[model samples]
Target: MSNVTLHISKNFKELLQFLKSISFSRAIRVGIAVTLPVLMGIQLGYFEIGLALSFGAFWSSPSDVSGSFRHKIKGILISATLVMIVSFIKGYLHFQLWLLLPVLGLLTFTIAYISIYGFRASLISFSGLMALVLSFANESEELEIYQYAVLIGVGGLWYLLLSKAWHRINPKAETEEFLSETFLLTSELIETRGKLVNPHEDHEKLQSKLLKLQSDLTTNHETLREILILSRRTSGWSNYQNKRLLIFVQLIEMLETAISNPVNYHRMDVLFNDHPQYIKRFQDLIFEMSYQLRMISEAGNDHRKLPKNDFMRQCFENVRRDVALLRETKYYEEYLMLQNLLEYQEKQFEKLKSIKRLLGDPNSTEINVIDRKKAKRFIAPQDYDPKLLLRNFSFRSTIFRHSVRLAVTVMIGYALGSIFAFQNPYSILLIVIVIMRPSYGLTRSRAKDRMIGTLIGGAIAFGVVFMIQDPYVYGIMGVISLVIALSLVQKNYKASATFITLSVVFIYAILSPDVLSLIKFRILDTLVGAGLSYAAMLWLWPAWEFVEMKESIEKSVKANKDFLHKIIEYYLLKGHIPTSYNIARKQAFLETSNLSSAFQRMTQEPKSKQREMNKVYELVVLNHNFLASLASLSTYIQHYDTTEASERFKTATEKIAFNLERVVQCLKDKTCNGAGASSEDTTLFDDQLPVFNYLEINTLKSNDTETLRELQEAHLVWEQLEWLFSISGRMLKLSASVKLD
Candidate 1:
């Protein structure tokens, strides 16, 4: 009994921590969105009618996630248009149980499936879904179609106006906030990189944590990126300010490169096992960078001048000494890796210097937007067309499956209410529709939150309704509850549900004096809906991310191979980088990011389901570091552009590309054992790709010291190339070990 109580206490504390971490700004945004309409309705002496408008107004969620202010207003416009159209037609086609079931089903499926168009489109779909359900309200028909349409449209417009008003006063607010968040996430990434190099830490657990952090950091960066792209600057600021903003945007992309370009932790640990000094030096370097980033974050948050990181030259000197020492060692591979790390580390340092110069130097402030078009055109990873929606209308699409499941569940729930003649059928269907999600884990989570939230909220509503008899007091309570509900809905659903329940109780108290009856009905309806949702989730199209893991990993491996092939070909041909190379790079990053996501989801599943977690981590780590190595070599080319392709490099790169393809084939054939790879030793130019393709050292007769220097530099790059090829070979074995069956 004591142990159980202790466990419960621990869980409660964790829950408390989570609730405390909810964003205050988001809550405030919701508050404004909900309160403005209510106040307007009260002033016009149409309390109950205005309350209905609040539901539509809330559809915009005040457009807070990301997107330009204009885009947000456009969202409100589009959503209002959708609600207005649906409201106008709702009265004519009265919904009957049998007829409504099929119609609702189709609408839910169609709207949900079409969300793949983009984030804005997804919000519009959600608005359409909610509007249709609300339009079916009993009192809705009494109001003339145009009157109801105007109320909802006005409510939406009111929220949009409120949101934009705040944004207009401080256009850089979102950008600054997001930039701070980006740098903060970068700091976290640097710390994680430090952990990766620490030999004492459990690398598997570190990888798991890194995977989860990547998901969160990626989300934060995307939101920040969208806001910047959509937002515009007013003429109050000079060209320097505009240029500074552009540099901040560039820094964000640099941060992404840092986040994605982690070295192979296992290899690093092994390499530095006896050399704690080297690991310590890198850790110190990263922490200093992290500190510099935090200062940059501070500058973004407040207008305070960022403190200069004056240690860049000192760090460089230290690295130079370390490189000199490594060069003296017989192990050429380790020397090459450390050299690559130096170059990779240099990129981050350069970014810091750029940011510092942009922030601190008064002379730098005189810059102008040389090309307004180029300055404004900060295209994100992608921006697709809405017309491309049809391409995903297949059985293989996850969104399609999710749509079908949602339609079935909500329809069944609605059928229960309509067939049995329940008083509030819409309430019942709404709960099921909102609670059911695409993933099993999420569905279970939402159902639990919804049930707890409703019960707790219901109890609180019953107490508060009678305690506060004044209608005016209840009105204030309604606003407060709405703000709490809207804010927590996405972050902590149970908390949102509780407040939402409270808001509904108080809001309805204005119309109906019987508060207890409303509470009782709300609880009963929610319970039945929750029950239906739980059942549907269990019996519905069951899909677990881990169950789909094998395919995701395979795709990632193939994508990486293709990308590496392109990189190698670029080197061999010594030609201009083609569009295919860029395409391959993007696909590779996308798949790797996807694999990280899959691994993250796998961690949420039962441990038994994770067939080869360690192997998957190894593969992910290997590919990430290999990409970094490629980027390092790419940077070298940019600096030393005059160096022509070496014959030895051509042969080594050819063999490396060939073996990488072999790895892909091995994975495809489910023969990842790293076998035939060795046997290819049918020793031609070299027996089957040897672990290390030791090139015969040809003594150059060039007496010119400059020529020797050039050869020496080329030799180092070749060593880095050889090291990456070796990593690919190891990844082949790891991939083979993954249990596809």
Candidate 2:
């Protein structure tokens, strides 16, 4: 019972925080999108046309997710053009049912097909939406028909001006929020990673938590790179802000690597599960790291008196003592394991120390950089290259199939509306276009949410109409609804849809004075649209995520293989790791992350579709372990100069990469024969092992103490390589087991 109360309290607090986080900047931008245009339209005695103009403004809102000041400005221009083109086409073909029907069909198909490109998709989706609005306006004369387009263009342009104005006025606010959020998220990640080191921790539950953390981390990092890196590059910030930002960005990336220990906690548990003395101290060390992360955040303006790493420096003595004890007890393997973990802790401490020095003093000696690759900008704006998209386009694409299905659904909905001679013929048409997606599950989910939202929203709008006696009150309500809708559309689709429904209804009550009929038609149209969407999803190109799961696994294998090869190549080069090598590692980890995320989604799917669920889970776990082992090897490479490269170690790395490719081929070809080639454990680096009695203790332990220390360090790196090979062998076994049937 107490647990339940605490859970509720925690959730309620999060909810409150979420509400507080409502982007006032975004909400204000939304105000300009609808409120300004509506106010202007009302002043011109065009009160009835607010809905149409607001629709145009709403079309431009999706571009707000991630864009620089320049990118934002360019998006607005492109969006405005799209809206105008869509409006012009719809207006020119008004009331010519037979001719317009074919044109509408082609337009829907064209827009849906081109949605393979993300930015083009947004522009085309907005244009298609406005085209729906164009058909809704009651018109006769050519000029009157075109007037609707002009008003919507006014709204689009207004939104553009407002967005630019906000950035010009307060560029610092967004970047500051981004920086604070990144650090705050890092603090959360630190605690999470600390808890993960617990041996008794639930593996599945922790993985689930990790997935969520990773998703959030990815978003924050993208935000960091987009705002901090790009805005500074474009000369939109002060020199001080830019320099400080550059420093912080480096720290953040270091923190990212430090927290990303891919070593299995279970393995840690096995080593220290019986030794509470060792385990407890390790836990304390992690918690201390967590504490430092929070302190960094709390430092705020007082960088001069920020926390120190005296605790970590003191703790390393105990860690070293534990390693010494294990070394004497015929537990050389365990000592090596603990040493690697200590290496990680020490590295983490050094990063925080470096960060502290840079922050407090603003000038520090040449700091140690684990990653020597030069910082490169990762600018990922929406692509506008039609030629590139077309050149790589495949007519056999799933997106293409989805486009055909969407065109069919739209035509069917329009035909149904026309046959019934409905007053609002778009009741079915718009919903069909809006709800249909490439995936059956998504379309079904959207249909359910839209219908639920529309009903509740309509009920609220009806109550407002019954209570309010003034058109001005209705108008005010509409503006508030627009603000709420715009703020949440991307964040909470159902809630946004509800507000949108109420907002549209309120606008009609203010203008048309026929509340009952409007509500009646709106509800009926929504029902029809939702039903049409559902049917199309059931019968049309149904792309199940589970069906594509195998391909995703194959890609994961390929990525990991390439990653291993790159790391080996860097080792061969005996030079600083290149940018391309880092990129490969990033891609591999991301692919593994993607595969894990996909499996989570697949779990949410119907059980019948979740084939080989256990095998898939094992595969994901093995892949994670493989990557984590590689990450451990990365730490080994960091300290040592890649010299006197052993032929055995190089051969093992080569074999692992080759094995991964074979695993991928086996999955693709559905044949595992000769794929999981078992090799003898002859590549064992630990000569102390009873199974490998190749070297004498005297040779490993040199007469000169300093030389002995150097030999031990080399031996540790050898053990790390062997450990990685062991993990790779297991991955091959797991890959062989990954079967759809």
Candidate 3:
């Protein structure tokens, strides 16, 4: 009983926390924009006009996500324009069913196809689709169809103005919130990583969590880059901007350090198997660091004074003490690896302290001005090239197939609804649009979530109608439900769906007398539409993740190779980090995350479709490890001074690059010749390079930190390159086994 109660309480607390998140805040803003017009229209005897305005506002709100103010304005305007245009066409064609069907198909194909541009464009396209669906709503004959379209356009502009006003009132709110969330997720990632130190923990489950967090962190970092870096480019830097930007950089660097810390959990376990206390100490310090980061995030969110991190300092002291104790153990060779991990933790600790200091003192001069040209390189520009659209208009294009599938499904849904003479035939089309996705797994998941949500929402609305008949109460609940629904749409689809049903039912209760009938119709329409969506996805040109896995894997391997090349270049140059290096690193992280995500989706697919599951899993694991090893290598070089690049190091990198190229070719050509490293390749350069023998190094009794640092750098670089070569060879073997060609 106590355990159950505790679990419930924990979930309740999490719910409360989510409600306080930035997503919820955005939802409230959108809800206000959507509902205010209707309420005003009711009071002024222009309820119909208000409803039209509200529709416009609601459609445009989807594109009002975080970014530069300029981007936000541009997205909102594009969405508004698309919504108005779509609404006008829908209105004029509604009375002509023969014409409306073909027009709807073409419009759906065109609008959905435009999503290939990118995320913001996808949201804008979604807005247009929503407008087309809602334009099916019966309108008062008092206003002409064109007049209603104009009012809807006015509503979108009204939302734009409100959104702008909100920004002016609190310009940094979104950026600050995003940064804090990033810190929090990073903290969670650290905590999960700490669990890997335990011998009994489920390593695979923990790895999955880490990958999921990485995917989410990638998204947050991209948005932050767009917000902070681009703003710096266009608006110039302020003291506040400088502080935030510095903290952002620290956050990213800290993530890299953390990711690289766990190069091989199996190795760590083996090294510390006898000295469990050392593992405990390291784990405790990591947990403490994660705790301090959470405190920093909380402080930033609440505008409170940044907390003192004396505990972190104490934790590091404990870890250092343990490291000293490890020196006396028989694991002398393993001590270096442990020491490197300790250094990584120390680097993370320093970064956290720096972030706290930067946040606490806005005037701090710790931030150096980044070059404008270099900074601009970090922001990835969206390609709106019309040529891309033309290129993708084929059966081979996933987006094209998806667009066609959706159009056919929607047209069929409309025809069925019309034949059955449903009270609200458009609801069927609406559900199809809301639930269908480009991928089979997502569409199936959405269909399931929608059905469950509609049922629960219907029950709740039914109970509410039975107990209360006050229109004012209905109005209040409607807005609250709308806000909650939109907020959770991206985070929790089932919860969002339930609230969506509630909001719709409540809004209808205000205008219609038969609340029960409306609930029944909503439920019926949802079931039919969701079923159709699931069927459409399963049978209509399905793009299975397994079928696409080879492409994803190839992209990831190629990205890692580029990243490795950049690191090698930096090692040879020992100069400023190039923009291309950063770009390559970003691509590596993104592609790896994409591959991980695709693998996850593939697992959710039908068992028969999951070809070579074991091989695919191994490949995913190897690919992730390769990136982690590369990160470890790069992190060490970036932080410490090293000797000039030698011929031996160049030779080793070439071998690794060759292995990676073979893997890529194997995926493309389904053949691998001479995949494994030859004995000559492994030892060809060993005779040419100086060996930093552990025993000899200690015999010198040298206290020169520079000499010690150089030795460590050489040893780590050589070992990392060897590890990369081994992993790439394994990847080549696995790629050959998968038989992608």
Candidate 4:
């Protein structure tokens, strides 16, 4: 009994966390926009009109995602216009199946096709499609079709105004929330890396966590970048913007520095082979730093003072003392490795100090004024070229395939409803539109979730209806469920489905006497919709993950190559890093994240479709590790004083670049002469593992500090380059092994 109770408690806590993770404020705003109309209509004895307004608000709310004010407004306005158009057209054509069937197909295809524009546009397009779906079920006989359409448009405008007012009330809310979440993620990343100090830790699990965190952090960084940079552009710069931007800059650099911090566990184990206590101390110190960042994140979120503690400095001093003690021994290699790690710790410490000074001290004048014109380069431009739409008309284009699949599925669903005469034919239409996706995995998952949630929700509603028959109670629960349903749709779709079911059933119970019948039909229609949707994905132009694996891998490798080129350039021209270098870095990170995400989705697919699964996983791991090794190389180059690039360094980097290029070509052409051939054919670097000769180590120990630093820098560069080259070669071999092309 105790164990069961504990399990329940744990799950309850997790449920609360999941709910808190979603933006309750946004959900409340949506609920308010939707609920106010119903309340007004009830007061005026016009429930049908209120319900239509609610539909418009619900459909338009999906476009209200976090973004710049201008883009947010633009998305909402476009969604409003599209919803009006879709609703108006659907209203006029509903009475004639012959006209409606063909028109619905065209409209569905066009709406799904517009998703090619981008994420925001895809969401706006979804709003329009949703409006079309809801329009089929409209029974507002009092208003003309045009009036109903106009009322929906007005509801969208009402929601838009409410959103604007909220923004005015708390202008920095989204920015602060995103920035704080980034900080928290970064802190988790730090703690995850810190775990590697322990020699017995599970490396695979840590690596997986690292990949997932990197993927999420990449999204947060890009979103926050858009919000801050684009807002500054529209509103002009201010002290408020300056402070936020400065914090963001520091946060970004901190993440890069953390990424670059080399976690060479093998070397650490060898060096501290006998001194495991040092590892424990180091891990504790890292956790302390992580905790400090967590505090800063919370403070930033709550508008409180950032921490200004000396705990990290004290921790660093202890580690330095350990290093000093080791310096008296004959362990020169161990001393050098520890010294290098200490230097990295110092850099991290300095970054923390900078952020603290800026945030905790208002009079600190360390604001780096960004060039407005140059800043635009950081925000990736969205091309709305009409040619893009036409170009994607081919069968090869996934969007085109998805568009056709959705149109057919919708028409089939409508026909099935007409033939069988389901109590609510529109219910089947709702399921088809809501569940279908561009990928097989997503559609299958949503179908499963919809089925399970509907069954569970039906059971719950059946019990609730028998136990309580009060309309007022049903009304309150319905509103609560609606808010929760909208809130969880993005975070946890299964829970969203359950709540949506509850919302629908409770609302209907208030209007109809036969609640059990409604529940039965709800479950039946959902099962039919779910089954039909998944069947469509399985049979109709199934976009198998393997088909796109080659392209994704190629892009990721190419991005890494470009990033490596930029890092080498920065080393050669060691001044301030150029914007192009940062851009290359961002692309590399983004592409790597994209590849990881694709691989994840592929895993969720049917086993028969998972061609070359093992090799593809290897390729993903190789690309991810290659980026990490490259980041390590960049970190050392950017932070330490180093000698000019040697011919040996350039030769090794060139070979690595060539290997990456070969991998790309192999992926592109589906052929490779041999994976081992070119890598083994290199002259300057050998196939044997990199090692420092005893004589070289002795020589370096005797040299002056500056000469030793330069030689050590060169050695680290050579080692990283060779490792990266090996990874690239492995990628080429794996790409060749896969028959993706």
Clashing pairs in 3: none
Q: Which stretches of candidate 2 lie over 4 Å from their true place?
A: 1-24, 44-55, 95-99, 130-151, 232-266, 291-331, 353-395, 420-423, 512-523, 639-643, 672-676, 679-716, 734-737
Per-residue C-alpha lDDT of model 4 across residues 336-392, encoded as one tens digit per residue = 666666776677777877777667755545577776567668788998999999999
> Candidate 3: global Cα-lDDT?
0.83
* Least well predicted 10-residue stretch by lDDT in candidate 4: 694-703
- What is the lDDT of every predicted structure here? 0.67, 0.67, 0.83, 0.81
lDDT pick, better of 2 and 4: 4
Model 3 lDDT, residue 286, Cα: 92
> Candidate 1: lDDT of 529?
80
Q: Give model 1's TM-score versus the native structure.
A: 0.81
lDDT string for model 1 (1-741, tens) is 999999999899756544433245556766766676667777997765776577667765534555566777777788777776666655556666678788778877876775676677677767777776666564553567678777777777766776767666656656656666677777777777667777898876776666666656656655654565445655555554465566654565454446533235556677888677788777777778877787777565343567656675677778768765765664555665566567667777877777666666644546545344443333343346655667767756667777888788778877877788777778887787677766666777788888899889888888877577888888888878877787677768999999989898998898899777778778888888887776765566655675577677668777767876776677666667665765565566566677777776666655666667777667776766666566556555534443666565666676666666766766667645675464453244333233454222223343654553454456456555656667766766676666645
Worst 10 residues of 2 by lDDT: 688-697
lDDT of 3 by residue, 64-144 (tens): 888888888889999988998888877767446666677788889889998899888888988988888777876657778
**Top lDDT model:** 3
Compare candidates 1 and 4 on TM-score and give the better one: 4
TM-score, prediction 3? 0.94
Which prediction has more favorable lDDT, 1 or 3?
3
What TM-score fits each model? 0.81, 0.84, 0.94, 0.93
Instruction: Please give the lDDT score at residue 94 for candidate 1.
Output: 61
User: Model 3 — which ten-residue stretch has the worst lDDT?
Assistant: 695-704
After TM-score superposition, what is the CA distance of residue 170 in candidate 3 from its true location, in Å? 1.5
